[model samples]
Target: MELWMGFYLVSFLNIARCVPESSYTVHLNKLSFEKAQNYCKPGSFLTNIPNEKEMAKILKTIWDENSKTDTSFWIGLKKDKGICVEQHLTLKGFHWTVDNSTQSDFKTWKVEPPVTCAILRCGLLSVEYSHSGAKSNGFMDTTCRNEHAFICKRNIQLECPRPEILSSHDMIEPKNDPYTREIVCRSGARFNLTCSKDLVWTVAGNENVDISQLCLECNKGYRRDASGNCADVDECKESKPCEHECQNTEGSYKCLHSYNGNDINEPPQPPTTTLKNRGNSVQTQPTSPPDDVRTNETVLHIDESAGDISNIVVPAIIALLIFIVLLVIVAAIVKGCLRRRSIKLARRKAEAVALNGSSSMEKVNEKEET
Candidate 1:
């Protein structure tokens, strides 16, 4: 019971005294500085020490298993020949080996690095933990060509598992100050989280948000139905994005086009010109596409069995006949209108002549009577 109480006391004091830093993977392979940086590729890089606090944390992590004696490890620091050194501050001339190029004000050195260019340029963490209760581990400048064990690390402020993200590393925003992140749940809900150089994420507005409402979203070419389960999307019915004809598959739609009433369109393959180098001179040659890129398309072969093509000739004859019939109908209507107009003009002429003759006869009668 007393040991348990003592354990708890030690744990509390340790937690209270040390600010939490993220965990890192230690690589024990003895590699040169350049090779070490190459070994930690893509997702991680050599660890950086921003201050004494981070330096102590790294020491504690490295010497946790064997804190009895002295040891050394490679950190991400190399002297920049162009940078101006400040005598007033710690880590004065050196910067962290990150893209941000940050320098810590809390540099504690074991031995003061020489201002002269004769000494080595790389930074090394040398600890003299001769006994158990040693706290101070200071920096030293050494040659980058020497092989030493190192650790690779990256700070992950937010961790949404693989399936949750629409793509890989979607939630990881390393560029944001204080490492703030906002992730969308599969249910179209959002949660905001942030961390300050630590692994555990502190949920923003934790009291107001409910995590029980997380819903699972379907994969691509799928959507949630009324029952809250994944259903195949009918893209053809919904959007009609295809040009000629659309056939709905299990989770996708296929567009059917035509060459000459065929089912598909074959894309034209272009020849690629490649350069060949020989004896300081270069030659260009045409190359076909790789076998993986070449597609085998099925097309309905055109029939050439018959001499006369009824398919083309019949449609042409029918179109010609229709055009002639339409022309004849139009001509007949025009002739009928012309004939009616002439007849009406003749009737009017006859009426005028008859009236003139009558008038003349009446005038003659009057003269005779007189």
Candidate 2:
């Protein structure tokens, strides 16, 4: 049971893994703390300089020679509810330096303490004066009103931008599988599309894609044809994926069983399945149609109508059994009610007889006295 279960579980899980694309952007225009917040979209805000790594990236990429003229940039961090801590600013037991509602211990405060002024609540990245000139460099605290260039960060859905060559030549649109990123170039022409770092273009149709390569073959349960098109492997054509019957899906296959005049579409539950004591391997033997009369090796003798009949018959049998049980219960209840009514009627008749007898005796006695 466990062996068969593990097989399909692992197979499906392989394809379930995919690369989630996320990216960040930088804005060059200068804006104050309040203005920067308003300029960003609803989900995004002024860049939160959480750790040294991200701070380094911003300096390397966005803070260029042009930034030397105007050094400092506004960051997302601000004093919450006018509460400020001299040492570590902890908010409600969580560090407020991180953004996106996530917590991180990383902090890059400058050697000097932040400005003591209560109004200077906003965060800033101070630039150093190098031989060239002012350089966008490190972290500092500044007033919210201070006018400085700000950086905005947001999560974005990353996609391989369609190649310019295809658009210039008026070629058909490339079909991309979002899961595996297996791209089928237009007009059956194989275009070598390479993904950026941390992403790879896989063969696509499979449930799992190889993230390490530029472009690779389709994974198990799928294969590419002469035209380099990926399609589901037909496990049923060769033999059954299951013990009794095989049903092929888009990228995978299903096993089926027929028992008690019903078709059960579940794997690991093969009819006439015998578990061997050695290695716990499951062995299934064909029950219907004697093996001696079988001629075609590939084809199994299966009644297609049996599957249809099983679907209807199984439900009907269940309903009939339920009705029979309910009828028995109702009959027993009626019998008990009639027995109780009969006992009460007998008690009333005895009481009436005793009263009649007593009245007759009294009348006879009065007649004698008269």
Candidate 3:
């Protein structure tokens, strides 16, 4: 299949904002629905016109670009069952199609078919001009054999030039501020916008909007981050959802817990054996693993080894403290014994000196009498 790549800039102006968006080029060549699907880019396919609003947009696009003819263009819708299908798509008994750009269940058929059949399979859209030159557009079904100009659609990711967002990320103040300018945003970027007075923020041509809300909030599970950008909350980091292990996912978290090496949420139950009576004796039948040893999920339970260690460590610490106290008492007793022995030796030396001095004095007095 041949592949074609082209880029175009489309202006997206809603009630509260003006955004510059990137889009794929519409193939002006004439081809059937199957051929149009084949000629689309690698990541693209035949354009899908699912709803009235998108149908109007596609009609406007064709009228603005190709002024040569007002021929019908083939869309991605096709007849799958008794009902019309969009791009041969079905899910859970629902009829819809998601092109690279948008998804919708809206159909703008000029007249409802009395009975649907295989002959009317593919869908066709055209922009017809009235007698007063007013444009009228609608969708119709036809066979897939006919050739017509078709539109190819693919997703476009456009980054804004540069945007100046408020520090607080409050939409109310900015929507009413006079200095607010056109804020550039990337493709598919969402923002919270609020209305100042009575004007409601809705699609350009859509009238069934609730004006009482006054604010178009971002989708649930998304909030402003530190960078003032709306992003999904990382439940793992924000709330620590898991008891042991938590893995962050896009808008959710995977709670993971393991007991030893087993990661399953619940352990397998142990089998039970029954004793059968054989008239005079009872026989025990072997079963699966024992229940006491089979259950390994002990994540929230305390470890027996930890209790054993504490049981041994606390007594050891007390014994060591007692030993130190006994060693200190023994050292004090030895010091007291040595002090008493030194005092006894000093007293003996003094007594011996006094006795020796008396004997010398007696000898000297006898020598003087002679």
Candidate 4:
């Protein structure tokens, strides 16, 4: 029984080895502070050296991987000091100023002490060992430039659940198969199940079933063709189905009607005239006007001619009469003026004669008095 148990344990170990393992790796590169933060984003932890518990796990992983201890690796601790210190520490030969300075809580110092005048290097700290009662003093400092090993936590491998097999009494056996059982009904056919765990169960006699024919449903905005395939259905191709024009869209179609033409609902077209044919035979009608209408029409034409004559001749006659009347009035006024001038001259002469007579009489009376 002991030997059998040992053999069983060995077989289980071998089976476990045969199962695939799920693991991932992280690469170290010249990453900025932001990039390093992104690398540890969700599902990953930033490697820290000062945490004793976490450092122990990291050290185990590093040992298991046979990675070098001297190689430098990054850590979550950042240089939180002022920019002045950062610049001072980054400048070569200026590290002497920081040498012997008190270590900062957030900043991890290098394992190997830097030269007094050397530039300070930044990196993550890894704890090499753990001490009891107090904080672990096993922290090791590595240069930020050094490439070293790191650890990543992941979920353990899971085994797929084994499908339960039914006994003959419990199984619904297919009519054609005594060993196989029907599992699922699909398209008037039964899916058969066997004892194979890895292989998927399939229909017993449908090994050559055309899968393309099985999936004949058309996609959205498409219709099934005669060949059981999807084809684009142009809704616009249907005559006057849309108010204006139809546009095809994914899974559906749309009618586009715009108030861009005479009719918003109808598509614009060039002007056309519609004429109906009475018959194939042609007929000629009389061109002459009817007797009664012809006489009335002639009268209307004569009246129009008379109106045209009045429009031209009446204005000319009125103008000529006005000119002649104006000339006659001027002549009469000139004649009247000449006659009045003659009468005035005659009256003046008579007055002069009367004055002369009076003057002679006055002279005679004066001479007699003398």
Name the best candidate (by lDDT). Answer: 1
lDDT of 4 by residue, 144-263 (tens): 444443333322222223224332223365443223454422323223443211223333445443322433344655764333335786655744355445666555566565544556
The alpha-carbon RMSD values of the candidates against the true structure, listed in the order shown, are 21.8, 24.3, 26.3, 27.9
Per-model TM values vs. the true structure: 0.36, 0.34, 0.31, 0.22
lDDT by residue for model 2 over 120-220, one digit each (tens)? 36667666656544444455665678787776654334444443332112323323333222333333334333443223343333314333222245677
- Pitting candidate 3 against candidate 4, the one with the higher TM-score is 3
lDDT of 1 by residue, 1-370 (tens): 9999999999998765553345555666788888988776544578887766766667677666554443667778777665554555577576668653656755678877767544447777776665554455677777789988776666443443322334222354433233356655545545556432233344564433222222445687887443334679998899987666677777777766655444466555467686766676777666877888534433222345766678898999999999999999999999999999779766655665577776755664564469
Q: Candidate 3 lDDT, tens digit per residue, 1-370?
A: 1222222122222433533232334667788777876776444556665555665566566666745464677777665555433334321122223333334665446534335333446666666754333253555666778888877665333121222342223232243332223222332233333221122332222334332222234456566432334578777787765666766665555665565676457555455576767576666565777556534322322335534578888999999999999999999999999999778756655665577676655554464458
Best by TM-score: 1
Off by over 4 Å in 3: 1-24, 50-53, 81-106, 117-120, 130-134, 157-370
lDDT of each: 0.63, 0.54, 0.52, 0.44
Higher-TM-score candidate among 2 and 3?
A: 2
User: Which regions of candidate 2 are displaced past 4 Å?
Assistant: 1-22, 63-66, 89-105, 111-120, 129-137, 156-370
Model 3 lowest lDDT segment of ten: 1-10
Ranking by TM-score: 1, 2, 3, 4
- Evaluate model 3: give its TM-score: 0.31
Ranked candidates (lDDT, high to low): 1, 2, 3, 4
Candidate closer to the true structure by lDDT (higher is better), 1 or 3:
1
Backbone clash numbers for all candidates listed: 0, 2, 0, 4
